[model samples]
Target chain A: MEFNDWAILEKRVIGWIRKAADHLRASLSNPLEISEKSAHNDLVTNMDRSIEQFLVGKIRDTYPEHKIISEEGYGDGSSDTNGILWLLDPIDGTLNFVMQKRFFAISIGVYENGRGRAAFIYDVMGDEFFHCLSGQGAYQNDIKLSPLTEIKIEDALIDMSTTWLKPNRRIDQDIMTEIVRKSSGTRAYGAASLELAYVAAGLLDAYFTMRLSPWDYGAGLILLNEVGGLYSRADGEQINILSRTSILAARPGLHEYMIQHIKEQVAEGKFLTEPQ
Target chain B: MEFNDWAILEKRVIGWIRKAADHLRASLSNPLEISEKSAHNDLVTNMDRSIEQFLVGKIRDTYPEHKIISEEGYGDGSSDTNGILWLLDPIDGTLNFVMQKRFFAISIGVYENGRGRAAFIYDVMGDEFFHCLSGQGAYQNDIKLSPLTEIKIEDALIDMSTTWLKPNRRIDQDIMTEIVRKSSGTRAYGAASLELAYVAAGLLDAYFTMRLSPWDYGAGLILLNEVGGLYSRADGEQINILSRTSILAARPGLHEYMIQHIKEQVAEGKFLTEPQ
Candidate 1:
């Protein structure tokens, strides 16, 4: 891909996302064939696969050289990560879509040589588009988002699933409870992509989750990067773009404090899914 | 008040709530003078006072014989729970208002001889108005809400602040943790009124909070009552409409199961605030 060619590619990506969102809105009223993937709560609907097909089809037709990674197995099983890669999650919060019918998003990120070039997270119900380029500023519905500044841990509002604070194999419940008790408040919106978008927009101060796939945080990481937000795995290692891992994303100062506390309290060699 | 007077009173109360919502929306753009009350997380703003004054003045002018109770000191300090009582919370989820500038609401409930006559919870920013008259059914922006049916605890989506699941004086941490583990999911939106409105709308299955003032849960209980939802304290006692108490509200069968489990696990006479 040429340097100047990136401009035309972004427009094409955003156009595809908008088209995919239309299909999602149309599926709201009609009956959906729902099934559990691995766990009972891990739901997947037909719309998830349909939207992925629509976007993946458009991408393959336009850029045949690009490789794809998606939630619904739209790509070949391979370990190579040396080309232009597209990470996509057609419906990030599938449970929310299945039960509440809202708070879900379509997330996609374009990477070159494992480096993000463009990202978009479309909130289908709210119709808010949060997107960003590699080094350029992030935007929500064409309005530029301000760069994040330092925030104190005492005043921070952490967004996390309560399951982590409950007894879990990944980490001790007491350790996570201390982190929540020290924060000003907590919210669990049940979507990683939208939760990360909230951190980029400064609506939420931090987000922590036990495990997420590459597609869950791919677009969010790009958006957070442009806004000066920070992210890393539980063990204080850089996140792998091709594997599942625990996540802790926040603004500059608070991330350091939270990650240090997590590292200090995480059990020795007992994390349910360690960062690889 | 006469039987037909209830009909005219409902119109006036709803009208006043809409006007109050407009003032709240306007305050969103203006600078708010904030101060902490009791605790750092317990935030109150200048808009709270101004809105309370506006609504209280209207109630006095229209119904001089009615008694009032409110968050701010707009009502006379008294233990009287008789006559046509009006309970008002000028702004519930004050922290959400001061920080996110959304999710807070103006909550009010009207009662005659300790029985609710009408209730309203208005989400100002989202422009959603949830209201109901006694035995007339609930409505969200003029759309009638359906009556709630039985649901199992395993499929329940419980809404509660994470603080309760942490080490607390009211109940043992393990007890609350069990409830969360059995439930499908949990959310903390930081607004009691909106959480209850979600219950009335069937978006959430149950709501559990340790302590809430009458003003916070007044309108919500009425809205839930019309939809055939159930409520009580953690100790299986009726809620006193004049005092602060622990709240556990859910659909019929789920509430019975949860309250029994809670009563069995809570330490003997250790609940921080018991229902009087």
Candidate 2:
């Protein structure tokens, strides 16, 4: 896509995200009608679906040719990212939105011909908008964010979910435990996009989680790419945006160190997947 | 202390905490002069001590007879809580303050005759002030907070540090891991006072951490007390306000459930302290 096209799309998308945020704020006054997704802990609410549909409608109206991959079934389900692809997570942290009525976000990533072109994550309650254009620097609410410098493991504060520390099917608990022990601190905000935004803003050094979908970290990945951050599968492989996989994202050296640590555990036959 | 006295003191202390918050906001504009305390991860900063001294000075100038037990050296170091006592943590999440420039808090707990009388925890950047008196309910920025209802373990969202989930010297990591797997979700805000306030506000069902000082949780305890929250050492014993100890604070039923779970681990010999 041309730079002019990217700028126009970015401006329109920001307006759409702000409008969706207003809808979210209005919906919070009423009691949420929540339902379960894959598991009881995995939740979806009326607002999640409504917001996703709202974004999908806006996207379809604005760019009729663009395909969308989104949560809540408001997507084209295109197998290949051949053209303009929009990945949308209308309510990234639905649990927080339903429970605390805050800490959720609207995340959107735009890709042209399978290449990231622009991305945006709007923290609805905090009123902070993080955005980036491919090859351009990321910004937090108009201020350009600086690239994260390399941090020592002992000085790093990691962002991870508690589920990864238990006997889960994805990775070994012992390996995850070592990372927790080695890092200076760990935080779990229950919002992948916000956590990724924090990584881009240098608020957190890294964030890793097992079993996240494309919409969960789609915009985050684009934002991180602009800020000199790295992301990969838990076993040090490239992440497939269409598949559910474990993720480890961090600044340059820390990402390499974590990947090395996890690889060593796998080599020692300690990192296990669930038995078939 | 009399209700009249409590009201007057609460007004005075709120002013002091707000003033300290303003000072914290101003200090963030300058580079932090950070130093280590006990270990590399254990941090202290110039603002921590300066904020403590400022609060101490205010307390001394207003009520010279009150004794203080604080993180920095400005405390009276009184062992006995016989008279009026002030427990202060100028910056509860110093790491967050120094790193994220947000999420930290100014915590102050006022006790009279060994009982919590009034408390305050101010989120400096968020501009949220949580305060409470013994009999009255808690207030977050002048809005009175409601009491928390009973929550089931399966539906609980816990606030805990990742350090406690590993093989630490305090409690068994296996037991903590089970709690994590069972809870609905887990969050680590990296600030004890803010986490405690979150529990009181019903944003999180519980918060637990090992080796917290009196200054770290004193204000939070008071706020939780007003909202019918229960707190104790992880081993189900009363927390000593003068020493470092593990804390498990939650709504009524969930607190009991967690305590019972921990005790069961102890009975099974799975809970272990480091070999002395």
Candidate 3:
């Protein structure tokens, strides 16, 4: 990688994100064309499609050699994460887009040779732009983010969807129930990238969720990496990035503590990720 | 009540709340002297005490005959809400102030003869002010909030702390778990008043919490009432201003559905509020 490659790529990615965000912010006044993907709760909107298309178009035109993986069906869907790769979630919280009108985000991560090169998470309504380049500092808008300091689970503020705390197919509900009861507090923003950005920016101590697609998971990993944060599959394994898995991202000590505790729970025989 | 009572009181309350909000925002740059309240998870800050003192001073100086109820020990300790009553949660989400540095709010509600006359919930860092004069529509910042339209539980975006979904002494965990699985999405902002404001602004379809004091409960009720929303105890009973009770606030149809569902669950005997 060239010295100026980071600067140029970061600028171009941010520019595309800002362009898409501007479109989204402006279109809030207009009616959205929405359709459910699988369930009524799982929503997809025209804004999601348009933003994905716009970003994919920009990437394909400028970096034609790049492979794209995205949520809204514009991706190349290459079998492996080789060469240059772009992972995008045009709207991280589609329900938020239609219902809340805020808290939704556009997430993009650029990877080269299966390593993160640059990542951006733009919160469209709030105008909070969280981004980072490999080995450089993470940023929420203009201010550079500080590396996260160690915190205990007792002192930490955790963010995760409440659905995970209920009886679910993903993981044992008791596992998260214990964490929520022990943590300083818990919040659920319903947007993966923004919640992860909050971890990087120190607004949240950690954010863990079950089974996020690559588009929802990739950019957040890069942001956390830039902030000296740690992440793994919730069952304490390495993230495959290509497969949907539980994500647990936190500061150094809390990450390890959570992973170890989760492992201990799994060892207890009833707290495994997959229930029979 | 005088003819000009609503107009005059609304202006004065907004003025005081904004003054308190400005103070909170300006002091955000300074370090807060924070201490745990009941436990490590429950926090209180010098900022909280100081804000309460400031608002209490203002109210007392303005209306000596009126009674004050507040968090952080600035209350009059009045047993009932008879004549002019002022409820204040000088800093809601005190942990957010110390840790996240955002999402905390200054909430104030004025009641005349046990009826809500005016209310305000201001987000200091985000600078969104949710206010209302009873019978005169709610407003989020300068924009007038629309009356909540009917929404189904399946389509509603709900907000509440995830802690309520766990096994607790409050409501049955399965009750909220069912609500979580049925709702389109759920969010927990960690501030009760701000979450209620989001509901009034139509950003969320509903917000429910296990228990809240009158200071945390009053301003939100006024905001919801102004926007034609509904609220009752999570057990489907009328709220008593003097007591800490579970609050189930929502738009018209969804609110009824939740209450009825919770009642049915309670009737099953596994879902009672207090176990024998």
Q: Top model by TM-score, which number?
A: 2
Tens digits of lDDT, candidate 2, B104-208: 999999888778989999999988899998898899998999988999988999998877777887877788877888888999999999999999999999998
Give candidate 3's whole-model lDDT: 0.86
Candidate lDDT values, in order? 0.86, 0.88, 0.86
Worst 10 residues of 2 chain A by lDDT: A267-276
Chain A agreement with the truth for model 3, given as TM-score: 0.96
Candidate 2 per-residue C-alpha lDDT over A63-140 given as tens digits, one digit per residue, 9 for 90 to 100: 998899998888987788788888899999988987788899999988877777899999999999999998878999
- In candidate 1 the C-alpha lDDT for residue A198 amounts to 92
Every model's TM-score on chain B: 0.95, 0.96, 0.95
For residues B1-276, write the lDDT of model 3, one tens digit per residue: 443467787788788888888888889888888888777878888889998999999889978888998988787867887888888999998888888888889999888878988899999889899998898888888899888899888888898887778888777778777888888888888889898888888988899887788899789999999989999988888988877778889999999999898888888885546212
Backbone clash tally for model 1? 0
Off by over 4 Å in 3: A1-4, A274-276, B1-3, B274-276
**In model 2, where do residues sit more than 4 Å from their true spots?**
A1-4, A272-276, B1-4, B272-276
Question: Which clashing pairs does model 2 show?
Answer: none
Give the Å error, residue A215, model 2: 0.5
* TM-score (all chains, Cα) for each model: 0.95, 0.97, 0.97
> Which has the better DockQ: candidate 1, or candidate 2?
2
Question: Model 1, range A1-276, lDDT digits (tens) per residue?
Answer: 543577788898899999888889988999989988887778889999999888889988998888899999986534667888889999999988887788899999888888888989999988889998888889998999999999998889899888988787676666677788889999988889999999999989999987999989989999999889999987679988998888899999999999888767765443445634
